[model samples]
Target chain A: MTGPLGALRASAVLAIAALATLLQVSLAPHLAWRGVGPDLALLVVVAAGLAWGAHSGLLLGFGAGVVLDLVPPADHLVGRWALALMVVGYVAGRVRADLRPDRRPALGTIVATAAACSFVGTSVFALSGLVLGDATTGVGGLLGVILASVVWDVALAVLLVPVLLRALARLEPEHAR
Target chain B: MTVLDLRPRSPEPPERPGRPGPGGRDDARRPREGRRRPVRLPRPATGRGWGDDREPTPPRSLVVALVLAAASLMALDAAGALAPVRGAVAAVAGPAESAVSAVARPLTAAPDWVRSQGALRDDVARLRSENDALRGRLAAAPYASNRLREYDGLSRLTGRLGYAVVPAHVVGIGPAQSFADTVTLDAGSAAGLRPDLTVVNAQGLVGRVLSVTRSTATVLLVTDADSVVGGRVGTTMDVGTLRGRGEVGPHGLLDLELVDRDATPARDDAVVTWGSQGRGPYVAGVPIGRVTKVVSSVRETAQRAEIEPYVDFGALDLVGVVVPDGTRGDRGVIEADGTLVPGEAR
Candidate 1:
């Protein structure tokens, strides 16, 4: 599915995804509010999806999700996040596809997509865990995760997405870009 | 036809005033009736093809295949079929994580280090002079009785309580992802650290070992909402069940529900762990916390109170895990005199 140039881009995307996951898992607690931190890995996947399109998004999200699943203290079914993040990537890609970047308000689009991703990703995870009888969070806890995550991601996207888009654009072949 | 084509076309017709621009705004001209009106123009075509420059959506089959793959992996992991795979991954990731934590720890403590640098130097200079004076005193005192007395007291205490203890350092804390109250210890199964081993620090009980890997083990903090420890009041010796209240504010608090209905534990009463059945999970006589507030009950049989834990869950560094020896026979309960005794005799 990937050519030589495409593979390079994918590798770069994957590296960023892994670093984001590590930061989220390790350092984010120090900056948490009420026991919730922004999901940096989710932001990276969403950005990749929007900038590179659905295929790139799906692949990045899946790989990042798998890495998160394998990380210690995960203590849940592997690939649970993989499934949720994949959906987030696809939806973000579709939104980007519908409204060409040149025609849309850049910051508004990024914020909206990030907010949607956080909400959808968290809801899917909580609901699936509940169905599988593995989740301990109640409705209030689920709500807190969604609310806190969306607020944090949107704030971060305003600064992060534009920079990420520039980097991603450099990775794309000149002709394709 | 050639003569007509050779003739120059009449000068291009002059454009009318007030013609609108490409942006749909027009030049304004005064009407004959004295009212000004702006004329609007139709938009010119850019000639770019719609959706031609855009990347096409990925094939539906690709998405479905990926989803199926993810679902299958999830199912396998949930069924515990992927334990070996998970373990292999952890074995690699755990050490890398620990190394990262080791580097990050200093950075986090940078402020404290900076603050103490000046004081530390002064203290070192002062201690050097004091050491010289102390050496003189030591030389003059041929028989130092303080050291011998201290060792005698230590030996007596250890002899009274037969506890196999292994000291370990706290390596890392709960990640931000789950916000769980847990700590990773440097020692694991290699050091005889099995799951359910009781861990404590200098102050009081820390928590129990939840899981152990080859090189590290994760301890579940007593401050975790899921943790429950059997506790007793210091003065009244009233037994109660102690539970973590999660992070209520700056730190975590414990709630105690006394088993004895008539026992009213007062403020400042020390709480200690009621011994585990076989010295598993928790050991007897470990200080848990001090009572801050006592809530009286009229309708209910049990009394409740809030406990401020002795150990600071936020700043744990070094800890000790009590490893039990099976030969100790049946574990004893804490007597009113604060001594361990056979439960039957009590």
Candidate 2:
């Protein structure tokens, strides 16, 4: 993928990923229920996995997770997110391969993967907080956050998948090899 | 001719007897000639050729690359080399963030509009309730006239302290999960703010300055668990140490440990910083809070009192940082009667 057209597609994907991450960070907080916001970055990682396959998704997930860990108010060890998100991306990619390329299956995969990713991400975060003995860490809050995040992520997936996929399709050719 | 050749036959040598004629010799040479013919070689291998023998060790290379990448990331994170990278990322992200906000602005605005419509109704109801509450306060004002007079006296005392009051705005709030309970103020080093400067608001003591950049500073709110302030309680003249007990509600509960076990603390006794002879970070006579509950134990050397901070940490907006003149020495002064003295002019 070295031609001008390939470069365009790559840039588009990068831009989309960045945009999605920003939106997730800023907007998701507003939708928070009981101090648990939706993990939009996780959803984006899952979507990337579905679109591009395992290798790209894992790499992208790792990078995005590092970025998330660097944001304000982060207390957990840095690489913790990197490892968890890589697993999420890889698993989402495998699941994507099994699903049909049709619109319904694509949407379904996005929603399901978003929920799974959120569960894994939040659990890892909560466990890290507990290990660090952070003052705000509480078992009840962790469970509440995980549950709320899953629901929020799933909802976002339902709305964002088609729009993202269509945008991606426009950037790439009709036939993908 | 046949009669003359009948008696002329003789034996031939063994080496030459079986020699083939010219035609037979030619046949024997055919196979040898075929072996001597030049053989044609296969075509040169192209870079993309299928039969190329030099295969890449893909798994080994990938593993090595991954390990190297991980090591580099860990090193960068540990050494804080990623700080500039993170800043660059934040810069780039700013525009992307704006673009995202622009696209989602309409969706976000709709909710605000809906919320405003709901707020209108809420506002009318709130006003009606407030009117009723004000009427009740007006009726009770006569009975509470003495309390108001006391507050007026306190305000006048604060004014006479000769402290130049500078009002600063709260620009940003730290996340609730943060253990530090810090807030960023718009004021910075340029605004006469220095580390360990005591911050207060209209209610009482707020916090102290932690770090200052050119245009901003991080203030560690007094509600943080780690914060400890040397203070004294009211005109009863008891010396105590005040420590934050984390976030319990709108106002943090300060644990006051008085130096004298025999000291009797009254309810609503004022708490002020135990200023060092005009040289501590906090100035004396700054109202910290009031004693809420007192715990007395005969075995313990010091009595403990629970203090309710006057400052509402949740709704904190404007604050004042006491800028001590000259040296950053101890500014607190303790009087002979055990009460904290107000600001001492250097």
TM-score of each model, paired residue for residue: 0.44, 0.42
In candidate 2, how many Å is residue B122 off?
3.7
For model 1, state the Cα shift of residue B9 in Å.
35
Q: Candidate 2 at residue A136, lDDT? A: 78
Best by TM-score: 1
What is the TM-score of each candidate's chain B when compared with the real chain B? Answer: 0.48, 0.48
Window of ten residues with lowest summed lDDT in model 1 chain B: B35-44
Summarize candidate 1's per-residue lDDT along B1-346 as a digit string, tens digits: 2112223432323345657534443322333232222222211234111111134466678788888988898889978888998898789778766676666777645655876898899899999999999998988464345334323332333334445455567889876466568889987776667899888765678899999986688998988888999998878888999998766332789999999888888999999989777876788888899999999868877889999998878767666666654212122322222234432221
Score candidate 2 by DockQ: 0.04
Summarize candidate 2's per-residue lDDT along B209-267 as a digit string, tens digits. Answer: 89888668788877788888888987787898888887845667889999888887989
Best candidate according to DockQ: 1
Rate residue A107 of model 1 by lDDT: 84
